[model samples]
Target chain A: MPDVIQIKAFGMIAEAIGSDSLEIENPGTSLALKKQLEAQFPGLKSMKFSLAVDKKMIQEDTDISQGKEIALLPPFSGG
Target chain B: MDRFERQVILPGFGPEGQGKLKQSSVLVIGAGGLGCPVLLYLAAAGVGKIGVVDGDVVSLSNLNRQVLFGEKDLRKNKAETAVRYFQDKYSDIQWEIFPEFITVENAQELILGYDLVIDGSDNFPTRYLVNDACVLMEKPLVFGAIYQHEGQVSVFNHGPNSCNYRDLYPQMPSAKEIPNCSETGVLGVLPGIIGNLMALESIKVLSGFGKPLKNKVLFFNSLTSQTYEVEISANSDSKSSIPETWKDFEQMDYELACEGIKQLSWNEAMKLMGHDVAFVDVREPGELPPLECTGLMKVPFSTLSSQLDRFEDAEEVLFFCQSGIRSQKAAQQLQQVYPDKKIFSIRGGINALKS
Candidate 1:
């Protein structure tokens, strides 16, 4: 396995990230994965968001598995 | 057996549920898009008391989603107009009008006595404040947010297993990066779908008839007519983010939390009529409610790139539109191209200045 991860974005996060979903190489942990994403898309460094693995939101460093579905969600202000 | 007889005769909801609804009080935090439909349904359902909190006046551009007010109601305070319009519709229900924004100074006072708080505010600062205030007050909150064709609705701080907004995302994005509805157009019907869901959730919570959205968020994509639910869990860090006391909450800076682009008042914009400032109208030439005073070169926001050379001779540039929202976006675009030049958007646009 290449240890690849599937990514999905919603709302403003999708707006900034262009495509709604993509594949990225895993960085071992959820925290490390976010660092890799910010490096690729610098806009994410300034945004407040959370990462969801297999539909569950993760707050701390967690092991990343191959074929895990990840989602980047931002706080939406629209009423 | 009157106007409410249909719902009163429904399966699970009877006179007792009606009684609970009649006894319940709800405070809706904003009077715009989401607040309008939420207030309408609650009023028609005979919610005992409904309070509305908003400091904005109805501008022309708000007519799309804010169905409560009309042309005659324009320029009137939103909180007052929505309350008064609904007050006469229902005799048994009481409508409370708070013509003010829900600030830290007033959040607790406005939310404490109410049975539940429904957040319909349109900015990050207000959304965060509402979430934190609900958590601190120990009150149930029905949260809803819409972007373009998608909407998210959740019931937070209500049940034992419920999750607050902070639990979902602990940090708030800088306000400068986010766009309001004016800049990023929203489908007019989307808010109705979300706001009505909020009202339904509120009623379910108050009457104890059905399960409200506890510890879960419903994401609806109107474009495809599909809804996806994300099961959320409480985060320990989210709890720590809440201010421990009202004193700390009072010291919080909401403006700095949700800062937008640079803004100038209409009068300040007009003061540059003869100066080195280049007047740029970001709105299309045919857009309604044209500027009362002339001399502004109409460079539609959609075609701003090719027209950048027009302002080469100016020391400063002022952007304005029908309601001032698009102008701020134009200023941001120009700022990127002309980083060294001064740029500002008139705060309320020509609509605010016309009268």
Candidate 2:
């Protein structure tokens, strides 16, 4: 059985995925989540963003447990 | 009687805190939406010295958020105009005005003169350049940026366990990958709010009155009134990218470093219409009013790889799409195949030609 986690998308990520928040089966790791999300939304494949778990940004692959607060944060370039 | 009597009376931020602000200097880059509020508040807060750096001219569209500029200020240099206007209002504060954008050549020297830096720049190249320079110079940087209805604020390169902007997201997205406020449109209030938060952070960093956003980034959404903070950790990969010496720093080409490809306007593209250039439209087949130009070909981006041979005989290739975004991607893709070839993308694509 796969763990279900809450995902919060911000900025362009939200626009690309067409939602600000959603729930999906956990991909188990940060890198996997990025790959799965990119494959799921082709629009995201070309963009750059960082993934955070429970409010801490992960620079490398990290395990994801059920109900972890996963957030997709994209950098805003405008002033 | 102290001019800052009200602020000087605050509990933790009393005479000492006011003194810190009165002795500190800050360099503000870009005097647009975000810089206006930051400049005004910093001056009002009694900062000792302030420098304004902006190369752009005041346009009619800027009046909404760039409150410092008026109709009379139109067509005037932003940095000079803003500095003079605020200088008139606050004669006590010393001012440094640079009516030019910050470039790699001047970044280090310009930043070395100030104790702190505030980046209100609107583009990715300048943001990365400023962040790297701040990190290298060991100066505290107050950073703020806005999108359509959201904004981000953070204080970088401060405190013991400092984390810079690159630690949050190591790679700078290619130009046009994420649309800026000008392209996507922003509510004037969004930057105003973000800029205020940035100004507050700058004060905190300088006066040591409050806990600054060290190792953390604050994100705000105006439409939903939602706010969240993300903790950042130092990444060696990001730190390694910063130049260790002045020579290396000066040699860095920020424009090419940010993947900023050559983009031409409709008039410029039209000039080469009948020349030895191959104009390729990367839009999908049957996609609304097709572009009609001399020596034009339709090659959808989805099948671009399979159609590479179609442009083998052309001296140069120009790409266009519905909105110029995809066309940039197409140009980048083609350039990878023909590194020495002159490849260009039309800005705003067909929509630009029509409107």
DockQ of 1: 0.59
lDDT of 2 by residue, B269-310 (tens): 878765678989999999766767666799999999898878
Please report how far candidate 1 places residue B202 from its true position, in Å. 0.7
TM-score of each: 0.79, 0.82
- Top of the candidates by TM-score: 2
Please list the residue runs of candidate 2 whose C-alpha ends up more than 4 Å from where it truly belongs after superposition. Answer: B260-339, B343-355
Worst 10 residues of 2 chain B by lDDT: B346-355
Candidate 2 at B182: error in angstroms? 1.0
Q: List where candidate 1 sits over 4 angstroms from the true fold.
A: A1-4, A23-27, B258-355
Clashes of each: 0, 0
**Model 1 chain B weakest lDDT span, ten residues long:** B253-262
- Report the Cα lDDT for residue A72, model 2: 98
Against the true structure, candidate 1 reaches a TM-score of 0.79
User: What's the true lDDT of residue B186 in model 2?
Assistant: 82
Fnat for model 2 comes to 0.82
Output the TM-score of candidate 2.
0.82
